[model samples]
Target: GESVGLHLPTLSVQEGDNSIINCAYSNSASDYFIWYKQESGKGPQFIIDIRSNMDKRQGQRVTVLLNKTVKHLSLQIAATQPGDSAVYFCAEKGDAGNMLTFGGGTRLMVKP
Candidate 1:
């Protein structure tokens, strides 16, 4: 099969520091937004999510911020750890379908 997409870009930061990962979504009609983390050789794991109507959502040691006006989204990780190192992607889905469109991932590198 053909390649589904490109590899994730990388973000390097020190462990115990805060990290911010940013993404820009394509579809304005997209109402649901989710953040996922994919470790090496593993599938994407759900992190956090936000609705189009809302601006922000938070999870354990992670926070998702949405800016619908700019079609921008960001994920913040507090006290970053080595285990938190992974490729992170932002996905969105609309009310019309169950399918999700994923943005290119940003790989997080937590250096201890």
Candidate 2:
């Protein structure tokens, strides 16, 4: 079975600093990848996405890098802020369905 897991459950960083979140996927057949950000109790919001054909994708202050060789994915966030403190999840669209297979989830803690 394919599953996504985070390297860390929580990450603490100072405002204005950069953050990097890592994730691993179990399925190599996954073609589409997506990174999402979730607030305290809200649903996940789309951040950035990348396809298996590409290695990297960038969005506003955010970047998603995928490594098919190791079945790994990473998210980079620049200029961390208080408002950026939230949970991040990595999702992949495998053979299951159009829905995404989510990671274990990582909590981003921003220090003022």
Model 1 segments more than 4 A misplaced:
1-4
Model 2 residue runs over 4 Å out of place are 1-8
Q: Which candidate leads in lDDT?
A: 2
Which candidate has the top score in TM-score?
A: 1
For model 2, which pairs clash? none
Any residue pairs clashing in model 1, and if so which?
none
lDDT of each: 0.88, 0.89
State the lDDT of candidate 1 residue by residue for 21-111, as single tens digits.
9988877789999999999999999989899989988889999999988889999999999999999888888769789988878889999
How far in Å is the alpha carbon of 104 misplaced in model 2?
0.7
TM-scores of the candidates are: 0.92, 0.89
Worst 10 residues of 2 by lDDT: 1-10
